[model samples]
Target: MSDTFFAYLVTLAYGDKETPTLAQVVFLSENEAEDTRTVARALLQNAKQTAPEKTRFDWSTLKVHGSQSLSDDELMGLVAAAAQGQVGVGRVSTLKLS
Candidate 1:
């Protein structure tokens, strides 16, 4: 999908970090999408690199917005509380656009 066709805004915070990292994934805009994906992957890797030997962080699919133009605060909420877990993507949202 094109980044313009599908854009994602993700706000993530480390478990202990005071501030968070915000990334925008744009499928149409390969560059931006690649950038965000890279950051996400890097962050995931960083967390894994620091994780204790017997622990693991589950991979999850998070949605912070729809095709239109709005942000998913719920997804951000989950990310804010990011534990050694993943987001429940099964909850397909039909949320109203803002």
Candidate 2:
């Protein structure tokens, strides 16, 4: 059986005045996802407190499966190739949330 990994596409937004930042974080299991979310929330809260304008910080998470369980280097290379291939991908970042 192939190893599977969970990837969470986290979209962070600070009010409606600015565009949301997109990030992908990959984890090995549900427990890791929980831990990662806790850290993410704390960081966002701090950001909300220090913003120039007072705006509520919100984030949405989308969970996906990496069926092939690609390594971090492999994933980075793939994203780079996609960007170079005129795929319209600005920048793809994958966070290692082990």
Candidate 3:
């Protein structure tokens, strides 16, 4: 059987701080996650390495159905908390794991 999965593309903005702020969130199916992740990471890398600005861009890929999955709402809430510096990456809690 082919298992289905949900993918979230979370954009972040870092401005003179160690913690990045949430910029946007986009939902996609598993099929599109890899391609989108590749492009997004490439762009993020380019911006970090080539851009001469103080602001930095990055992204987090959340796959909602695996060992590292989180509920949609929970993930969003944690993202907001992270923006406020209340949490850090890999600190988002989850209730289900498979």
lDDT, candidate 3, equals 0.39
TM-score of each: 0.22, 0.22, 0.26
- How big is the RMSD of model 2? 14.5
Q: Tens digits of per-residue lDDT for model 2 on 20-94?
A: 323333322222243434434433343334422322222223211422334666444434432333112122233
Q: How do the residues 3-90 of candidate 3 rate in per-residue lDDT, one tens digit apiece?
A: 5544444443433356554344333333433443343443343333543232222224444333355567766565454445443222
Better of 1 and 2 by TM-score: 1
Best by lDDT: 3
Q: Which lDDT values do the candidates have, in the order given?
A: 0.34, 0.33, 0.39
What is the alpha-carbon RMSD of candidate 1 to the true structure?
13.0
Clashes, model 3: 0
C-alpha RMSD values across all candidates: 13.0, 14.5, 12.4
Model 1 misplaced regions, further than 4 Å: 1-10, 13-34, 50-98
Of models 2 and 3, which has the larger TM-score?
A: 3
TM-score of 3: 0.26
Candidate 3, residue 51: Cα displacement in angstroms equals 13
Clashes of each: 7, 0, 0
Candidate 1 achieves a global lDDT of 0.34
